[model samples]
Target: MIAIKGVSTITVAGLFAEVGDLSNYRDPRQIIKLAGLNLQMNQSGYFKGQTTITKRGRRRLRSLLYQVARPLSIHNEGFKELHHYYKNRANNPLTGKQSYVALSRKLIKIFFVIGTRNCSFDETRMLRDIPQLKPLQEVA
Candidate 1:
């Protein structure tokens, strides 16, 4: 896999080293769970509490992803746009930090695709596929 924007060589190596082989995982969601990035909902009967991460997997992996996400959202054009979209969406806008967390999860999925398929990252495809991320002019 090639180096993604804002992803350093060390970060990429660390990620690959942490993951080892991607064959065992059935899907990207599995990797997300492995990183403890899977959402956990605190809902019981009629009481629905906040949704948060499980935090039950590799702590170093989760921390590394978050560390990368913050800079990725600031330095990478695609990631930056996505981060802004996530934080400003109408339905349920996330805080800046929350958006970065979400981005970290997204990065996991991206890495999964890259590792499994041996394909390079496609920023334009990502931006295009998420229709909700279209500019305000188009939405309006």
Candidate 2:
């Protein structure tokens, strides 16, 4: 098992400082909410508006995740593949920024797993989580 590469030390330390103990979170989704990275709906009666992040939590933590997202998408093979899949998938493909936000959420999840479970990062498992990425794996 390899250490999770490409994640900066400062970012992880900063995230831990903001989030305290990962045990406090029931799951990664909870961590995502804490970072205000969760998707929010804007629906009033039948008029549904554009969905966006809530941006209601620690600003620094949120910003850090967002900042790491771009580099992670480029330098990390798993993240890069996931980023491409998010942008090009057949159903409701995300725009560039949207994909980054999604990647940020994913980073939060990975961080949560690391902090709470004390497990090494698994690239194969990470890619397996998203079915859309599977075929791309075989091709590449």
Q: Pick the candidate with the highest TM-score.
A: 2
Q: Look at candidate 2 and tell me the lDDT of residue 15.
A: 82
lDDT of each: 0.85, 0.85
Candidate 1 TM-score over all chains jointly: 0.90
lDDT of 1 at 7: 90
Instruction: List the pairs of residues colliding in candidate 2.
Output: none
- lDDT for each residue of candidate 1 in 66-135, tens digit (9 for 90 to 100): 9999999988888888998998889899998789889998899888888888999887766886777667
Residue 78 in candidate 1, Cα distance off native in Å = 0.5
- Stretches of candidate 2 exceeding 4 Å from the true structure: none
What is the Cα-based lDDT of residue 121 in candidate 1? 86
Poorest 10 consecutive residues by lDDT, candidate 1: 131-140
Instruction: Indicate the TM-score of model 2.
Output: 0.92
Clash count, candidate 2? 0
The lDDT, on a scale of 0 to 1, for candidate 2 is 0.85
